[model samples]
Target chain A: MFYGYFNGTIAPTDQLAVGITDLGLLRGYGLFDYFLTYNGRPFQWDWYWARFQNSASRMHLKLPLGKDETYAIVMKLVERSNEAISKTGKATPTDVGIRFVLTGGYSADSISVEKPNLLILAEMIHPVPAIQYEQGIKVILDEYVREMAEVKSTDYKRVILMAEAIRAARASDILYQKGGEISELSRSNFFIVKGEKISTPDRHILHGITRKTVMQLAQSDFQVEERPVLLSELYDADEAFTTSSTKKILPITQIGELTIGDGHVGPKSKFLLERFDELVKTW
Target chain B: MFYGYFNGTIAPTDQLAVGITDLGLLRGYGLFDYFLTYNGRPFQWDWYWARFQNSASRMHLKLPLGKDETYAIVMKLVERSNEAISKTGKATPTDVGIRFVLTGGYSADSISVEKPNLLILAEMIHPVPAIQYEQGIKVILDEYVREMAEVKSTDYKRVILMAEAIRAARASDILYQKGGEISELSRSNFFIVKGEKISTPDRHILHGITRKTVMQLAQSDFQVEERPVLLSELYDADEAFTTSSTKKILPITQIGELTIGDGHVGPKSKFLLERFDELVKTW
Candidate 1:
């Protein structure tokens, strides 16, 4: 039984609805942030919350609940969902994914809304297969640049429209470039490793929480550069990987027609993935 | 009483709701086109339908209904709404506004939806006050450029976020500029009149239907140039105006601190407005 924290109470997912006049639906005025929960506890909740607040502030959306209040609501919803599964004689999954969405509420003008609607969804977590990590994934180069690149607004039309192009390239994902500089993937941050050094574009990309954790882990033992990365640099790099909440640190072997450094999962990615797992277990 | 043609049925506005899981609500994946109905009839229905189809095509969104089929749905809904108002012992408004929306339907991934949802809304037309047309309205300059400028996607966060700045400047709307070149207003297309020549940015702007009609009417007696117009040109132009479905041909008296030619509605704008009225009456 999936549970959702809608507005102020828990409800079935199917019963959740937004008015047609809500600015979020009428004008696409909304923001969303999501993170994972491991072993019945939210992983890096503070980091995700900070980023959520930043996104909302940038979009001029106001969150109705405070940090602690919202945290309590999410935990309550998750607990209730797990208990419901147990009552049905089913084993509740220890890991789950939670999404926090803030939308511009009902408005007659369809341009701006004074109040905001907060929606929280708790669902079973779907993990990427271990084989994909063992064998690096392929990515294709795309020339699309997202608008308001820093904010995590609920506007992913460019990525949805590029689904066919990505699939035709026989790649798992896309790495976006604009003005000759590589920005990031459609859903993850892109990084290149070159002989003891790792670098990724610092600007015009979503500041992923997992990316931040990987950067911190990498900086402790390896040289890390946060700056503009050009397309030419990726082709010549020793290894490349992407970071996201779902994909912690997945290695990228092929980009377009070029293969990166022997086309195998690099030792650096393996080490970082192991370190990330250890950190998650601690959490 | 307002009525909405939702999917294949007409319903009350209060009952019109979209599921929270709809990709249109979750990811802001939707497009909307609206025009006014005059004398209980949709004005230029064919022209509006063509633009709607074009917008959906650009976004790779498939319309669930054919153009003629959708036209019938809108007319039926309008007729029913008028009948309801007449039964209430009130004067039925001859003019109303209709909005046709296409959403990417429900999707578990929230990125793509196979089936699209078509929603048509018919409501009382809110006409721009005659004072605004006679005395002209003020506008402010905005530096943000829309992504996928050709497709009329439901992403208006930039304008909503800039609402305060526009209000502070005592402007009715904003004229967006990219790289020192004026693109268009938030909801209308910007135009400038220089002596006998009138020009507007040909690219990176929504091709408004009213703008098309106005251009056709103006071409009969005046020079029309569809090219890039810079900010400097707007400041020095002899006349300026904006055109949209709701606001037909509104003169701009002031942009920022600079007052447009004589700080009143210019002669060209007055002439165009009269011609537009004549054309609408003919329709």
Candidate 2:
């Protein structure tokens, strides 16, 4: 009973469909953003909206609706999703994960852009296992960089193709690097801590909202440096972690074959996750 | 009146709809191949099918139907397309461009793979004007390399985003390069002729079927080198051109600000195009 907003109508997500001639499908010319809700409320509405707009603008797509109108649509979908879930006999409504996909619309010529199609989807959130968050997760390193790194385009073929290799390596995700410089993960931002300082790559990577929040939270306790991080820095790093809408601050103890520090969850990431939880609880 | 085959059903292409949960639309996890029909028959069917299978294999997508079954489906769509086009009162039916799109099917979780969705489309062929072929088209050089360059995946966002710039520069397409070596164009394979020799990049390209045909045709008259072509060599080349399913053999007279050898179609490209036309006419 998950719900989604396609163009102008709200329908069952499973029934929502896009026409065959969409450039988004034929040419992969689209952008998307994902965010979470806290008690049925959008955790960081403004930041998500701004990033969505930035992605659209960077990709030369026109946003059909203004901020207020789009916000109204998201809220409506949120309400509908929770109501539908409650009907399943749950005593309490659960927080939902929201995703916004804006694509270069249906084109008579498959290569050209038409009116953009906007799909806002609401689905049940699946939290990462507590054990992974507590004990830390593993990541593999890949020698590649994403095209249009600043924009969240629907071009995840490399990551999708790496599924087998990731599983074979007993890794949960991949950290990308190009020309000896580490960039970011397939779907999240990477950070490494050394002594009391935190560092993350600033160039050729997505400017993640969660990464920004963690940096803001770390200002008082640790020194944060946003610059190009070298691949050589990972071998002896004291700690490492990744940030995303779903994985706020999942620790990374193992990278491919290298183990970070004592091969356990680090204190800085735990501290930042606690701070993030506190901030979101208030929201 | 255009028709398409989605999964197993044939319908008007405009009415063909893919589910919203498809990884093709959500994550761009798909591969595509397009070839033209000559006299209502697929030209070089074996080569095209082989390349499509290679792309699918590289992208980790499984084709739902085998070659014989898929050929039956394609022939059905082709017949339907011609029948519908003939209804428009034209005395003769037109040859159509056939495209095969294989996507990483619908997934409840947007990131995982499921049964692949196969879409076969038949559309009117739009040929480049003879004037452009005579005068030659201009292309701009881009300092980028495609991810999974050998696969025909649906990741054309960079090319789509460069549309405005291409128009501004009065260019027909983009030629991608990495680390000072020219690879290929946005939608075609690139080549340069020096004296009685022609060379095209052997790595980081889609290995276009048309490119193979042109190389084979030129073997009797010219030395064909399938190796990395340097960007520095482009400036002084005697002639340059591109090959694609639609364009076949279109000459290039300009590369960004440089006018290639007096800015007119070169004799080598003309000779090759004439050979290609003769070869196709016999089919």
Candidate 3:
């Protein structure tokens, strides 16, 4: 069972709704942030909150609640969701996903929204299967650019429109490139590791919280570089990976037809993944 | 008393709602089309429908209703709205605004939506005040680019985020520019009038229905050129204006500190506005 915090009230996910006139629905003017919970506690909560606040500021959306208030609401929703799931004769989920959404509230004019509506949703976490980690995933290069690339806004039109192509290619996700410069993936940040160096694009991409942590962890052991990653560079990289909230470090073995580092999960990627898992426990 | 046609049911606008998990609300994955009604009859319904179909196709959203079916539903809503206003002891509005929205429907996963929710809203047309036309309007140039520039998706983040800057500048709307090339305004298409010639950006912009009509009308009497309009070109143009469904042809007398066409409405703009009004009557 899913639980949701709508505005200021906690309720079942089914009861959470927004008016059709909400700018988030009518104009797609909204911001969202999602992070995972481990052992019923939010992982990297402060970093997620800072990113959430930045996204709201970039989109000019006034979040209805402060970070602490939002944290309380999320904790309550998670508790309620676990209770509801237990009532269904199921064990409580060890981990769950939390999504905070802020939308330009109901509008009669359909142009401007003043009072923003906030929704917090909690659901069972679906982890990437071990098989994907054992055998790294393949990705395809697509020529597309996201709008408001900095803010985590609700305009995923480019990716959604390319859903068919991504599925037909049998690729896990797309590596977006504009003018031959690689940006990021549809839902994750791209990284390339060459020998003792790690690099990722620092501009025209959503700066993921996990990406920051990965960079910090990588800097401790390797030379980390944050700069533009071109499509041509990925073909020659010794190893490649993606970072996201749910998928900490996913190895990318192939880009289109070219394989990276013998087309297997490299030692660097494996080491980083292991380190990420170990670090998550400390949080 | 506002009326709305939601999915297949005609109900009060207050009853219109969408689930929080709807992809349209979550991912801003939706498309919309709006046109005006004159004397209780939709103006250029065919053009609006064609554009609506094109937008939906570009966004990969399957509209639930066909042209004829949608027309029938819109006519009913308009009639009901007129009746509601009349029953309130107010004069029946001669003009009304009709909006048709197609949203990626409720999704449990919030990533993919196969079913779509349809909404048809009819409201009394809010005409631009006469003073805006008489005194003309001032606009400012903004450095922003819209994503999926051709598709009319529901993502207006750039405009909303810049709302404060626009108001502080005392400008009516924003004229978006990228790399010195003038694209369009926040909600309208930009056109520059050089004596005996009219030009507007033909690419990387939403192809407005009213803009097409204006081009057709201008072609009958003037040399119409549809090409890229640059910021430098606008500073030297004799006159400028914008076109949309509601605000037919609004003269732009100033762009920042540059006064367009002697800082007053040009004769050509006046003539075009008059011609547009006359053409509307025959519709």
Candidate 4:
């Protein structure tokens, strides 16, 4: 019972569509933010909404609904999804993921900016396997940075084109490097732990909500540095990991052929993941 | 009158839509090519199709239909557009512009590759105003290079976000510069004319079909050089112009604040425009 909200109406995901003239489809001019619900409630809703607003503002787009209305719609979809599970005789309903897309809208000239199209998609959440999280995942490095890296634009052609290579390498994701600096992962923010200090690139990366939460969780116990993390520093790091809405603080045990710090989940990464889990469980 | 073909069905442009799960709309994983008709027939159809094929290959997308079937679908939309114009009581039917879009199909995971969705959009050709070509157009410079510059991926967020600045500068398009080299315009290929020499940047840009046609048209009389065009060279050039499917050989008189060769359309640009007109008239 996956549902979606298109404009003002809520409907089944399969029935939602955008017109052909939409710039999101025609020119790929749009922004999107994804986050999963925790215990049937949107986790970090304010943070996600703020980031979505920032993305829209940077892209010069207008929001179709206020924060309250958007939350209402998400709740409606969540209720519908859980109701379907209840009808299935399931005792415990799982969480869901919500995505907000704001497009440049329908243009008659195909170039002009008109009223924007807004779409919200909700799907059943699928968690990463516990073994992968316990053992950590591997990532391949790519020498590229996303254009307009600060904005959460819906342009992922670079990583999408790297699908074959990623699969061939048996990697989970691509860690983007540009000009000797490691910026971020394809879909998340990256961090490295050296001794008692934690560092991540502050520029040329999306400021992930999960990343922020993890930083706060470790602020009292470890030093947090949010500057440009150089590619050279990856070799000296004792532990590394990525953070996103879905993969909350999954360790990265390997990159390319280099095994990160003995090729096993480091104690620092496990500590941060434990803190993240504790924080989210309360939410 | 406008019509479009989606998958195997042809309908009015307004009635066409793509599913919400499409990667083209969700992640902007797609490629597109646009060309206009010459005398009710596709101008440079073979060249356009070849380039489209290259773009798809570079982007790792599969064409949904073979060449013959694609051509058939395009003709179907063209005929539908013309038929609608005939009902409007117009005696002289105008040529139409066809845009072929191939998107990463509906991905269940929103990350994996799937069968592509093909959409063909046909609209009545809207040629650039006669005066703009006579007086030439102005373009602003942006310091960025598109990722996967060789592929015609549907990522135009940079230029789309530049809409207000472009309008404020009264510029029709953006000229991309990277590492002191002038690459191409946001939607066209650029060239500078110096005396009898014609030069255009051959890398980090979309290889425009019209740009190729103009080079061939001028080869018999003018010296053509395809190489890295330096940003410094724009000031010394006698004339400049941009070529694309819609704006075929339109003169460019001003870039940023600098005037090109006395700030008016130069003789060389006029000559090439005349040649292009002559070549397209026969088709």
Candidate 5:
């Protein structure tokens, strides 16, 4: 369909983002969010906006509009995207994902200005490759600590750089560890399933949308304690997986040189993934 | 006259700065710099570009061209800018200041792209209002901290946000004190002139082009210590000033309720500003 939302309207998926002249791009002064819509209706879109608002507030950024105004803009764009998809026959089941990105607009070369540009964009749900889920993925631990691991700003150069360096050494993902405790993955929330209980690093992750959904879904199946999981915990865990918007609930069969359990998808990860699939449809 | 150096052959100012794009605007994943051109040539552009490259490398970002190629682009842009200003009456008298900005070029929705959109814009010197020199400015401290204050990324969301929020608070500038350490002003480096010694928290501020220049220029006359400046020392100074490309050496007359050095320009700040003017012209 029409990939996602932009501004206060929906256009083609290909036309979702903004121009390069925008200050957000010019200065890296923008904030964004990645979340999914449920059956054409954005699941927790309001919550996404809330987090976006919080991000802007944290950065002391002004999101062109208030909460209600921002919500209206998102809804309008989402509906427009749905229509575009229907017209183009790209609507696959009408269920999709959304990304809400906001920028500080443009600069007139002036230091102080009353108005700043506001940009928003959304996109569709692209399933992660089937290979990653089946065989699981390998991750490496980043020895050095990171800054701004809490906020979701566009300045992800270090995150990408570290991940690429890790990949060059033959790893799929890079996990940030502080002292001896693990924080989160570059883009996903990490979880360790030990015995029958499940635990994960708290907001060390992006407080991921999928991570939150998984936490809610697995409340009954396992105990979900929000805390930092050390690399030692990973070595002893029965299974490990990551929760992200796109990956949903993904298994981590191997980390560094060590294999988890039998070195394949563990029981807990599979059960959690099964439950995640069911939750997304309802969510 | 057009602000930046841009003409037929060379891009003029080289700071790995490139054109604006969706990727750069939305993500702030780029490198940038502003350096003064001595006469028609760059003074310390090379020094600034070194940090730009370091920032790019730190991010594991692959620039569009090698170091030499990028420098050529800047030289080209500067030539163009000079030609534009040559048409103006003050062309000979006017000096040049250039901004080098580069963006992560466009990609197909995915973030992993190898290429980047390069844009270089050069402009004449844009100094603060003349009145600011005679009468120092006021500043407010930011409660929260800015991480990686060293990276010269286009991410000014926090700086902008805090400035906007405190507009009504009679605060002219803002700087966050991280864990009780006075980190830096929003867009400039923080310094306090205590007697004959000029002290500032080393490395907590932008390794600013002007800041570095001022340090080198004043090293013979002033004892420059690059140690941490505590918040408690903010009021104890005879003078306080910040260094940046735009506001080379600006003295702060007041911080909150305290008026620094009899509420006027201190002797040390006055000398530095005077010396800074000569440094830029001769460099």
Candidate 6:
């Protein structure tokens, strides 16, 4: 069951009462974040809303609610979604994902400083296959540039286009490259393993919720450094992987024709995968 | 009265439905286009849908409808939106805009080879303020390096964020620069005039619908060249203006702290504006 939030109610997904006139839909003028529910509760809820608020602030658009109040709105959506899913016998509380979208108000004859539109949605969670833990996945390299190296907006023309190449390469996903350096996958953070160390780009891409969790998860296993990753380093790495809110941890086995470190998922990837799922189950 | 197109008939915007697991919402995986409706009919409909088709094909996302069929869907949206407005006794047939959005479908486990989700939305059009064209408006500058410059995907974060600066800068819009050369504006195409020659960076930004219109409109009045527009040239131009589907032709009064070309609307900009509107009435 998908819950649509508009007019301060939990309506059916098809009954969404918004249109292109909503600034977010019109100009791609809104910001949103996706987070998963574990044990019927949302994880890292603060970071998700904070990013949305930060993005809205950057646009100078009027958010419908204040910080705490905004969180309250999302909580309302989560609750409504929980109730709807409960009515379904096939689903459980822990099997849901949530997305919160906040769009700047519709364009007026000139400009109106009115309140922005808010829509919070939820659905069943989709997790990548577990076999990727032992075998790793191949990734075709995306030879395009992301529209903005920074900021989060609704225009997904680049990322969605790259998802197919990921499947085509017989690879699990893609490593987004711009000017020969890797940026991100379709909607995930990328990491390269050098010996026992983990490195990633510093906030040049969307700061994924899972990527943050992985950094926290790695404190005990290896030191994680955030920096610009060079393309040359990808070829020499002992292991590589991409992280996102949905997939959690996806190991990259090959880049085009060349495979990384004997062309298989590395030992460190498995270790991180185990740690990731463990946190999901325990935390 | 916004008509949301699903599989078959025109439905209420609120009743419009998309699957919960659709890739469009999940991965931000989709391609879309917006067209300015002239009077009651969509202008340059072929160009608009062509770009959508091209973007979808490049990204390997399937379009739910072909060119002629998609065209019919948009026309349905326009007719319904105009009716909705006239019923309220607030809008005229001339006031309308069209948007077509197509997302990859909700297939389980994989997204590359799934059926697509499609929606067409239309609403009353809002023109720029009458004063904006006469006196022009100020603009801010920013940058974002995207992964895919050629394919149109839904990833729009950079300019959306920079729009905040535009608001604070007391400007109406934003233009982006790459490696010190002005690439394009957030929603409009950037241009700088030096005497009689008008120059702008091509292919770095969306070749805006109104932008192309102006290029044709300027054939007899001034030289329109597609090339890398330098920062120095922008700072020293005799006049500057931006073009888009929404704003039509807008002259720039200032960029950053520097006053543009006598710090007011220039003669050439006025000429182009008159020419553009002349074309719009018949466009």
* Range of the 10 consecutive residues with the lowest summed lDDT in candidate 5 chain A: A1-10
Tens digits of per-residue lDDT for model 1 on B73-148? Answer: 8888888888888899999887779987788888876666688888899877777899999899999988878887
Q: What residue runs in model 1 are displaced by over 4 Å at the alpha carbon?
A: none
DockQ ranking, best first: 4, 2, 1, 3, 5, 6
Worst 10 residues of 2 chain A by lDDT: A85-94
The two-chain DockQ for each candidate, comma-separated, is 0.72, 0.77, 0.71, 0.79, 0.37, 0.27
Q: Whole-model lDDT for model 2 versus the true structure?
A: 0.90
**How big an interface RMSD has model 2?**
0.9
Listed for each candidate, the true contacts retained, as a fraction, are 0.69, 0.77, 0.71, 0.77, 0.53, 0.19
Cα-lDDT of candidate 3: 0.87
Per-residue lDDT over A1-283 for candidate 1, one digit per residue giving the tens place of the 0 to 100 score: 7789878978977788877888888888888988988777888899999999999888877888899998898888788888888899998776678988898888877786789988999876667778889999998888878888788888888788888888888888888998889999988899899999999899989988999999998888899999999988876798899999889999999999989999999999899999999999878
Tens-digit per-residue lDDT, A165-262, candidate 3: 87998988888999999889998999999989999998889999999999998888999999988888876799999999888999999898889988
What lDDT does candidate 4 reach at residue A165?
94
Per-model C-alpha lDDT, please? 0.87, 0.90, 0.87, 0.90, 0.70, 0.71
Off by over 4 Å in 3: A281-283
Per-residue lDDT of B1-283 in model 5, one digit per residue for the tens?
A: 4433322234323322322224565456666767766666666767877887876666556665666766676666566666765677554534566666665666555466557655556665666888888898888777755556677767666666666656766777886787778878878888898878888788566787777888898899989988988888866788898888778888888876778878998888888888887766565
A163-241, model 5: which lDDT tens digit per residue?
5567676777777787778877777888889987899887455667677878888899788889867888876889889
Clash totals, every prediction: 0, 0, 0, 0, 47, 21
List clashing residue pairs in candidate 1. Answer: none
On DockQ, the candidate that comes out on top is 4
- Please give the distance, in angstroms, between residue A109's alpha carbon in candidate 2 and its true position after superposition: 1.9
TM-score for chain B of each model, two decimals: 0.97, 0.98, 0.98, 0.97, 0.86, 0.92
Residue B246, candidate 6: Cα error in Å is 4.5
Per-residue alpha-carbon lDDT of candidate 6 for residues B1-283, written as tens digits (9 for 90 to 100): 6666766768766666555445554455665677777666678777777778888887677676788887777777777776776798875465467667776766564344368777776655667888988888987766554435444555454555565567778888777776787877766688888988988787677766677778888888778899888777866788998888887778888888878889888888888888877776875
* Pick by lDDT: 2 or 6, better one: 2
